[model samples]
Every structure is written in C-alpha cells, then in structure tokens.
Target: MAFAAACAAVLAAGTAPASAQAEPALTYIWPVHGTIVDHFRPPAHEYGPGNRGLEFATQPGSSFWAAARGVVSFAGPVGGRLHVTVSHPDGLRVSYSGVAGIGVKRGERVHQGQLLGTTADRLHVGVRRGEVYLDPVLIFDGDASTGVRPPLSRPRLVPASTSVYRLQLRWLHSGAGIAVL
Candidate 1:
C-alpha cells in the first residue's frame, strides 16, 4: 500500500501543469526604447490580403523581443526581411522582420519576452499566417509604466536596446546552429 501511495504522489507531481512548476511568462516587452508610434492593426480585408501583426515606431538598431515562449523555427536574412520566426507551444506563431546582422540561427529554443531581433530605426512590422492577419497588441500585455494600451493609437516609451543586443552577441558566438531548446 505504501508503494502504491508513493507511486500516486509521483504521478501527481509529474503531471503538474507547467505554470505550477515555472514562473509565468511575460506576455510582451517594449518593442523599442521609444513610444509606440502605431498600434497593432488587423488586416483591412474581411477575407483578403492585409497586415497580420502589430506595428511599433522605431529607429534603426531598435530591439524586439519574443512576446511568449516558443521554438525558433527559422532565423536568418531574407531578401529584405532579415527576420526571425518563433513557433509558440500554444499554436501561435510570431515573426519579427526588418532586422540586420541576423543573429540566432534556425531551430533554437527561446524564452518568453526574450530579444528576437533588432531593426533599422524607421520601419513598420508585418505579421501574417495563411490568410488570417490580426493585430499584435491583442497578444501583448500592456504596462501602465509604458503608457501604452491596446488599440494603441499613439506612442509609448520603451527600454534601451543594450540588453538584448548583448544577448544577441552571445547567441552569435555559439557558432553551431540549428538548436532545439
């Protein structure tokens, strides 16, 4: 009987939810160290082509972060995209574009609210799936300290790009690409 009881306890512990075992993931980070110039805008079409993600106003070399935890399915330079694509465990996929010196190769694991990439100072962001494009603010948790809200119509101050830039350098130094975690 004691053995059975111990087995039950072990099963219970093993099946615990991730949130119960780990700290909650940050839902969003300041896209750039500047006020949000534009808000997350959904595609204009009821069922046609349109913007899929949110847009923030930033200058060249601005840093961007992952809104949540996910696997880095692809990270490299496109013709002009120079983007990173993260696939969340929750079936959500986030993409960051308009970056340069593309860091973080494909197949890496990234934590929530971690730096994804940096972009040229004055660029707009676009996100999309097959046909359903939505606003990015919908996925971000607004912070009063930043003074930005959902349906953001103006700008909000963000943090400096230094921290993420340092992290990116470390990633690039690893050399070996195609990570799983």
Candidate 2:
C-alpha cells in the first residue's frame, strides 16, 4: 500500500519510525443558532425526573448540525421526537431530540458542524458519560454571538510536582529488576 511504502522510505533514509497517529479531537459547537430556552437541570435522585440536556428555541425545519465528531449510535423517532445519539471516541454520547428529520444514519461517522437533522419546535441537546448526565454548558464558552463557531476547549490535566516521582518495580527471573517511571 502507499502508506506502507511511505513508511519504508522514511525508515530507509535513517529516520525514526513514524509517530503514532493521535485520536480525533472532541470538538463541539452550537448545533443550531437559537436562544437557550431551557438549561440542563440536575436530577435529584438516580431515577428522579430532570432535564438532562439544554433546550433551544428554534423555528421548525431549521437545520441542526452535530456538536462534535462522532459515530451515529441512534437515529429514529422516540417519544414523538426525532432523536439522534452520537458516540464520541472518548466514550461520551451526545443525544439530540425534537429533530424533524435525520441526515445521518446509525453507525455513520459525523464531523463537527455536520448537518444531523432539522429542528422542530424545540431542540434538546443531552450529554452522558455512562449513566451520568453532564451539563452541556460546561463545554461551551457562553459567548457564541450569532452562532459563530469556536473550537471547544480540551480537558485539562492535573498538575504534578516536579520533585515528586512515583516508581514501579518489576523483578525478572534473570536477577534483574526493571524500574518503570
């Protein structure tokens, strides 16, 4: 294949092996340009009723795009609303409800801002990591004027102290030990 040949040529020139490809980023944007009518409400209990996603007030038949790049997990009518669930590579699933029509099918990969469906009376956006429903506003900057697209911020990592070092030791049968840093 052309990719294999390219790697071979790079290696033959006394260069290092190609670096591992990175996973696609979790970029999210406003799926539709509308006023935020209802914000996400946390549930009182595990089975208590609560708003899991944000609801936008958009006109009927307005096109709604995907908030992030992911694979379509579900696309169909549920509870009298056309719902579409996209599973991101990071194990987070975003669900859109109150859509009129779905442009993407189940198992289809969608890019950020890709058209997913037509908005109905109300567009609901829900996010869940496993069974926990998260606040959708946490991903947005809260400053999207006229729905201007802005790349979502990546998750931050906990800072580590420079003087702190944790080591793992594994003993081998050859009377040697390996120290993993």
Candidate 3:
C-alpha cells in the first residue's frame, strides 16, 4: 500500500521529525563539562550488547545538564546506577546514565541547559529517536572526545536492525502496512 511505502521510507531515512527538511537540527547543550571518552557503536541487532551512547570523562561528581527542552520520562537507578531519560520534542529522547545526586523529578519538563544530575568517572549519554538509539555524538558540532576541531558534516543515522523494519517489509508485502504516526 502507499501508506506502507511511506513508512518504509521514513524508517530508511532515520527517525527525523515530521517537519524535518534535511536532517533534524539537534539544538542541545553538551549536558556536561567533560572530555569525550567514548562514542556510540551500533550492534548487529537490537537489544544486542553494544554501547548505544557516548561517554564523557568528567570528575567524580560533576553535575549533568539537560541537552534540550523536554520532559523527564524517567530518572532513577537502572542496575543500581543512576540514570535519566528525557523525552524531548518531536519524538526524540535523550538519556544519561551513571548519574548521581538527582535534582530533577520524573514528568517534569526541562530546558536546554537545566541541571539534571551529577556524574561519576564517566557519564553515558544516549539519544533516541522514538525507540531507536542514536549516536549522541551525531548532534554535536565535532568530536570533542578526541579534542579535534574538524568541520562538522550533515547528520547521519546509525542503522538499526530492529523488528520494526522486518515487520515493515512483511506488512508491505501482505497488504497490511501502516504508518506509525
């Protein structure tokens, strides 16, 4: 169906906002004043073991800042490590792990530079478009982790092999395809 084809296109192009013309502009702060120590590495499949976010080497207890304006979907411990997940506008969500000294509450909206929490040896930051994990570094101007000043390029998405894509193709062939929006 035509609807299914559109859904497939959207998935192939990554989870950009509905209003996205080129790549979606990620207007966000660095969230913490730390050196980039790690980067997002996509796995062969969803739920597989992989580092789906970036890690920043900060002090023992550096406070983390909100990357953009959005509501806090979750802020608590995951596997005993403190974490925060913020649902930003346009179905985008940013998450911070290894946080401490929680200062924000769940369901509370935050701004671009608002304080979120403190960090440990390294802060893990992940960006998600809907349920798909994205490279947190993709939104930044350059790879600060390496201390390089290279020019930034257009945002490119990390391809994911989730069930959604498999189902999309199945639906399109079975005349049951549907758009998520």
Residues 35-114 of candidate 1 have per-residue lDDT tens digits of 55665655456765545555555777766766667788778767856778877665557777667545566788877656
Evaluate model 3: give its TM-score.
0.63
Window of ten residues with lowest summed lDDT in model 3:
151-160
**Residue 146: error of model 1 in Å?**
22
lDDT of 1 at 83: 76
The global Cα lDDT (0 to 1) of model 1 is 0.61
Best by the TM-score measure:
2
Ranking by TM-score: 2, 3, 1
**Tens-digit lDDT track for model 3 on 1-181?**
9999999998978876766656455466567777777777888898688888888898988778887788999999889888899997757788998886789999998877787888888899998876787777655544333544334333423232467587667777775466432
C-alpha local distance difference test of each model = 0.61, 0.76, 0.76
Q: Quick one: how many clashes does candidate 2 have? A: 0
| Better-scoring candidate (lDDT), 1 or 2 | 2
The alpha-carbon lDDT assigned to residue 37 of candidate 1 equals 62
TM-scores for every candidate against the unseen true structure:
0.58, 0.67, 0.63
TM-score of 2: 0.67
lDDT of 3: 0.76
Cα RMSD for candidates in order: 10.5, 20.0, 20.2
